[model samples]
Target: PFDSYRDAASTAPGTLPSPAAVGDLLGEAGVGSDDTIVAYDDTHGVFAARFVLTALAYGHEDVKLLDGDFSSWRQEYETTDEVPPVEPTDYVINTLADDAPIVDREAVEAAIDSGGTTLLDTRNEEEYEQRHLPGAIRLDWMELVDEETRGVKSGDAVETLLADRGIPTDRETPMILYCNTSRRLSHTFVVLRSLGFTDVAVYEGSMTEWLDADGATEAAD
Candidate 1:
């Protein structure tokens, strides 16, 4: 289904909804635990990826984004107002995995201090040059996905990009990724995992919380 008001099993704009709230919305939307969800959005994979990540946080697995998104779908097929049949399921969130997909500000800072975790900054070049976390491997979110159609780029495209930049290619490396709201970073997180990169976490606090906490930032020379 297209990314619409109905697709949002959570609150809108700026930040993610609470775990209980997301479970409630998804449960009512008839998303079962065993089901596979393909979330897509017109605003790029930004919102689409976020929805999948949120589902994972609430203990829902087997979800993925429609790689090309709704724009690609519309380009090929006629639109319809008909809605799919939905069976409401009482989806209670299972306890989170021991290795959660998210990390907090303090955890990130500690990781940076210890040099055990790498930070992948997913903001734009302008913002990256203006200010960024020290030692963050800069990668603008737009590069991972298309600008016009908002569809995700191919995995080979990203692999080549990372390799050309001399970025680390190890799968077991610990990494924390972030964007303005951590929304865009989710896309990269998924792509990296698909390429076999492990121990990746999304810093949901992101730059917004970093600034709020008066964390240190570095600028381009």
Candidate 2:
């Protein structure tokens, strides 16, 4: 189910999953529209951020990510591998949220052309050195994470990191983020949003769609 958010029917790489796909998963889990959805994972909430952001974009109003992940939970309480049964509902998303932080290839291209948005590449050094979208400053998402707990760093810590990288902290500065399939960028998206960034967007198609469309790229030595 890790890839449940991907559009299986689409031939396009990095396609966003349909609302029905998301709804079906939530429906089977008996998730209600108004229910508070909390997400967490062992991978430092990087994976959890994907679900949190996706659910929010699909108009689930109260999605949240646990500050600490399963590792932190297991140390404090009992663990469970048991799956609980629940009544399913006909969950459906009527519309995407107006403030959904998603952008398409065209939008990324336009941003690149206009130089109006700060573009961040969330891939690691190897992938970035190979190829990356034009004008993208390499920002490994883990840079904003705490090495000890593998959790997101404090806001002040994040601010310092951003400032060191020369990234703008202005709330109105338009920013676009991307990784191979947006999985990595999801974490960055949430962190930036928490810092009160209002105009942040994720290139859901990410590098996959960019490569498919022959989008121009830059490389580092």
Candidate 3:
């Protein structure tokens, strides 16, 4: 079955599905332990990570994230107007990770005030224009990987992207990335870690919680 979180969210009225529900949904969709599953979202990889973690929790293996996400896929590859059909298979449910990978509003507030770190916002320009956490710089995720932005032909693409944004890559500075929901941010996390960024972590709840709060610091330009 071609299950979508967006669809579930609309019907269920929640940001995420319960772990058991996710397992049941995937199982009903026939997702098997051996299946090579890929999950993605346009906002950020937080949602994808949830799904991946859910699959792993339910004992499913062979899961991988789609590089660059759906938008990037469309930009890189041409597709036809017609939709394609999908086949469903049984999936085994295995749960992993005791807690959700989410950092709360208070943690973000502390992180911003403490300094000694670079706060990167991976949302698009339009979203950044609406609002963002205080001291967070908009780094638009696509710009990081685009050949035109950094123009570097080789080594450590993530570092090159950060450097292009005037962020130093030395290990001394801690780096934290966040987005509306952290789906794209997860991809950023993966890229940065691969490029040897040692002190990096993602703000899981991200701007969603910050913006929803009563008096959290938020700015718009």
Candidate 4:
């Protein structure tokens, strides 16, 4: 779902499959609030991040991403096409708006207007060079990840990466991260949260929505 666009449902690309459409996908597959889930994607954490956020939103507290994702797992283990046996659970979610680290376009705009956020452009250098939101500091999402393994680098390495970029790591100075969309940004969001950043948010609508709304952008020199 790269370069995804919004639909009538306000979801990226298409609407989420209805509860009936999947027909007990969660219940039959045995997903529950107490489950510690591990999500992964072929392309970095692009797709996995969404599942991580969704799981957390439903009050599933221990969601994690497969570092380097499926690729990394392949290096350490064998493949299996056969599905694992699912232990069903009667878990009912209390969809309370959000339990994930997400923010909308309006909140991002307000943060920018108030100069209250250290905005990080988590897209590639090429994208950032083409055009980026005003005041966004470029930091490619992959920089914090191990190229071969696709796994995120250590916390010490992450701290150094941010420090080198002059990105604030303090609790008070809020930070907002974004990419062309937000998949890449979501990876960084998780890493930061793990590092004890409590005031971080991701602009899920990101550059796509920002540009759609005629938001201001600037190109690299």
User: TM-score winner among the candidates?
Assistant: 2
What is the C-alpha lDDT profile of model 4 across 168-220, one tens digit per residue? 87956688888865667777777777688988877777887888888889999
Q: For each candidate, what TM-score against the reference? A: 0.88, 0.94, 0.61, 0.83
At residue 221, candidate 2 shows an lDDT of 60
lDDT of 1 by residue, 1-221 (tens): 32321223423223456556666778889988799999877777777777777777666778887776777788888978899998888877645556669787898889888896778888888889999998888887778876655676777888788887667777888888998776788788877877789788888778887888889999988
For model 3, how does the per-residue alpha-carbon lDDT over 68-148 read when each residue is reduced to its tens digit? 455656776785689565455554334434433335567667788887768888889888877777778778866655443
Ranking of models by lDDT: 2, 1, 4, 3
Worst 10 residues of 2 by lDDT: 7-16
What lDDT score goes with residue 177 in model 2? 97
* Candidate 3 displacement at residue 9 in angstroms: 5.5
Runs of candidate 2 with Cα error greater than 4 angstroms are none
Tell me how candidate 3 scores on lDDT.
0.60
Backbone clashes in model 4, listed as residue pairs:
68-150, 68-151
TM-score: which is higher, 1 or 4?
A: 1
**Backbone clash tally (model 1):** 0
lDDT of 2 by residue, 163-185 (tens): 88788888899999999987899
Rank the models by TM-score, top first.
2, 1, 4, 3
